[model samples]
Target: MKQKLGNIFGIISIISAVLYAVFFSLSRKQFTETFLVYSLLFLCLYAFYKLSKHAFHVNYRFLSKKWSGRFFNSDVLVLVLAVGVICRLLLLTYTPNLSQDFFRFIWDGNQLLAGYNPYLYLPDEVMRSGASPIPNAAFLHANMGELSSGHYTNYPPLNQLVFAAAAFLGGKSIFATMLWMRIFIIIADVGIFFYGLKLLKLLGKSPYLILLYFLNPFVIIELTGNLHFDGMVSFLLLLSVYHLLKSQQIKTALFLAYGVLLKLLPLIVLPLLFKKLQWKRASLLCLAVGAIVLIGFLPFYSSDLIEKYSGSVALWFGDFEFNASVYYLIRAIGYEFTGYNVIETAGIVLPMITFLSVLLIALKRKNEIPEVLLSSIVFSFFVYLFLSTTVHPWYLTIPLLFSVFTRYRFMLVWSFVVFLSYYTYSNSQFTENLVLVGLEYTVVAAVFLWEVIFFDKNNLQKTKLNSL
Candidate 1:
């Protein structure tokens, strides 16, 4: 009966997920009703799985004990992952028009293809003209209200380059562009997992860690559900770090630069790098890579890269509304901001404080660079969270991913919880307001404090020993 129930739960989970994906794909937007139904289904499945575990007399011990002889192996994990991947592919194929700012990408790509600078025209102007040099109709409609008559795209040209490539291959069909772009993300997802596992193995980690990340709903939903290129950025960052540890310093620097070119945030890791290796070697290598990235990005990219990037980063300070952070205190003070200017200002000042302070402490003690990098990453993520104008659920993944190296189990659990918070914003029934956002941040703050103040020493010791 227990085994049967477990099977039943598994089947239900899969069916409900597929149903949600199918409905979302067809609708072109998430259906509040459908999402609610899917959430209920998942909760029910979770309950059933718990019941099955007890009834089947399955080993209740942790990964320390092997429960079902074959259930924990790589082959089983691979099969489970395959199902997840296939489901994502199916959903991507069916999902209606592009999501979020994908239409902007199409618009920008169209501009680029026509020899018009995307940064020069507002989306409204492009749509008003109705001259689709790129061919996706949805792109025209999506900009109807977004263009304030003078709004230019702030996205860097690299992403637009990818979109242009997809449009070139797929012609004017939105679906075709989505399909090709999504395929790249799908490949990136798989590559991230494979290389992530390789890095863990190199560090002598158990295969369970691989299963944890690969099977994570957060990863599945983010990479597949949203089809974000963040997966590719993540893969490159991890691969670069892996090479760095192997003493392939020059190649590692190049990869890091490449990662930054894909997404600029990875450049933050470079500062931490200079402190890691011999200052001369690290500086030269990083500079060389920076120069290469600039050459690639310079011509098509905006000259106001810093200002534009800062404007985007400025969005974080608009309020203290999201799951957990010191920003709650800031918002509580009743400071009003139209954008994250205050937060951006604070971020600029505060990160320097945290980084310099931590660097001094770590250098004084001669701590391993990995430990410093982990600390820097965590601090940078928090600063971003605290001042960020937009606090998407997946943003938490950046910090949480690095915590794995620190042997921070609490962070893993917190990551899953934060991942689950996707439902909060996702729940179309309830308007996402400060109260709800506050609750989410409250949980995140509690979790962060627990990990930092209470668990840091123990986890660090464990990680140190494991590395040795």
Candidate 2:
């Protein structure tokens, strides 16, 4: 009877997931609809969780031998992955409902395809001067927003290559460009699933755990549905770590460098690796990483490239504030004291603190082992996000991916709650509900603190027992 009930719920969950994808794909493109769609999506996810917990418990022995074997079979894994892929494919038919960033991506790619340097001209400047070189320049400029159009692009070189590929294939069709980008992202996601499963096996954990990331609704919607390249970035980071654990230092360095070129966030993890290798090999690794990054930049290298890129990056620290936590509190305090917003001071101080926190984690932790190193990287990323002036929902994807290798599940919890930040998009005014933002961070921080304290206590007890 129990087994029957579980299977029933499992079927319902799958149906619900598919229905959610269909509704999401067909819904009107507005942020106001997000709450309803996301709520239903979460309900389906919860039902799936209950199905797995109650019906598929490892110790449940009510099933026949054949059925039980089937439950744990490799075929089931393939089926689950196939379902995820189908959901993404369904979403691919619709325009991105959540983000306009893809417009900038297509625009930049068009620039590259036309032999123009994207970094040399801001979208507004190109459009205003009537000197735009890219096809569909007006459409992209109108959609990418004033903030994006005013700034030189900050996408790294490797990411530009991907964009260029999309442009070359997409030509004048926005849908075609988006489709190509989504295809690339989906391919990268497939790589992550396989590599993540292997990494889990290496850690002596259940390979099924990879499904948590691979089948995650957030991963599906944000990466494949919205065409975010963070999915590719996550895969490269995981591949690098996997190679590192296998003692393939050169391959590890190369993958890490590629990941850094895709998204600069992986650079923070480099310091944590110092203690994992001898000084001589560590020096070589650093040199190799530097050479790879330099090579990536060679084609675009010019005096203005540095200025434009660095200036664009500095805006994140100096100007932007969104879905923040510790930085918000400090900013609030500054506002109360000074009678004005003080992002200028808070931004600078917060990032400096984050830098010192990551440096300390690198120096203080015993990261010679793979698990220890991964945990430190996760912690460092958490600190950086906690201190960041902006915490986009997709940014949590980084720490969430890293946490899969460690004992931490706070980042998993974060993946769900981060969706609340999208409420800011409910209207064009872009007004944020501080109350919702506060609620989101409060829950995430509570989970993080609980896990940190309890995980450390458990580790200390294990250390003591081992010593005896």
Candidate 3:
């Protein structure tokens, strides 16, 4: 009877949270106090359910083990998350404005599929010229009345190519194009979730940790509901790490190369590949993989690829966003953010120093794939976060996903808190607002504290099976 009650409460809490978040997102593209109230209410109910179940009595092994009763609990959590996703998709079709980002992507894809260089034009440009037929097309018409510098198209070509393919398949229907591309991302997210679960299991993650990540409302809503492609990059990275764990050195190199192709940010993990292997072997692997990636990208690689690459690299050091690592710390202290270059120089140098230290430790440490992947993800995430000019909320998924591999439950919680803030940030609802900024910083501080101080390492270790 007690267990049944706990289950009922858990389900109710999840449903409530999902409804609140989805409704809040649709209403104003912002999570107001009312939404937070609902969130808190569900949180309280969830806490009560957990207490009734004596979550403390649940051993880490029971939580971490794959194919266990705990896994069923996780499945229930995922089902609730799926409900959130359904709400998001329904809103995408039914809502008038849908998403600002989605609007931009569809416009860009149409340009590409129409035999025009989308990289050379912004949506506002085409909309003003009466080129796009999508509804509320005037919403894209901007007051600037100037051509954008085409800098935002710096994202890798593979993403744009996939978007173009979707647009082509949808013919002239804008809604169909957007839906198809969104579905593609959703499919990739499924791969990320299941494979991520398997990876966590391999890493000796407790079933609870698996539940923490897989069933986490934040991950599901962001990757599945939002139809974000960050999941593809994350999936590729996890697969790369999995290959490396199996000691498939060449295959690992290829996988990592492909991951970087999907999203260039994964290149940061390259240092880890070299850290353990012989110099000759690492050099050969890098050369082979680099060749493959370059060959695949030959269609998009022009003579100006070098110039474009340099511009993209330089763009990172030109600005500081408050949500980023260490930059938030600096910004919180009243320091003005200069160009991305200046801060990135400092950010990159410091993390490289930290990376060297961690690499030395990693060499001596009996490392599992989960540990290595987690360390790399965290290290690279902060390094780029502090250094990069752009820090999108979806980027947070990179490190957050790997936390499960390390059986870090707090990361899952932090991911959700950060996810909640994303709606406000992306919509510019709280842009430069002091109160929202403070709230964000407070959450960041809490995450840092929870992960560094509160998380128990021994408890994580105890959850692993001997065979693992």
In order of appearance, the predictions have TM-scores of 0.76, 0.91, 0.74
Residues 279-372, model 1: lDDT tens digits: 8987798788778787766766566655555454444433233453454455454356543335545545555665565455435533345655
| Cα-based lDDT at residue 206, candidate 3 | 40
Q: Pick the TM-score winner.
A: 2
- Candidate 2's C-alpha lDDT? 0.82
Runs in model 2 deviating more than 4 A are 1-13, 22-33, 46-73, 455-468
Write down the RMSD of all candidates, one decimal each.
6.2, 3.2, 6.2
User: Residue 41's C-alpha lDDT in candidate 1?
Assistant: 38
Indicate the worst ten consecutive residues by lDDT in candidate 1: 56-65
Clashes of 3: 13
lDDT of 3: 0.57
What is candidate 2's CA lDDT for residue 117? Answer: 86
How many pairs of residues collide in each model?
A: 10, 0, 13
The alpha-carbon deviation from the true structure for residue 269 of candidate 1, after best TM-score superposition, in angstroms, is 1.2
Q: How close is candidate 3 to the true structure, as a TM-score?
A: 0.74
lDDT of the candidates, in the order given: 0.58, 0.82, 0.57
Q: Which candidate wins on lDDT?
A: 2
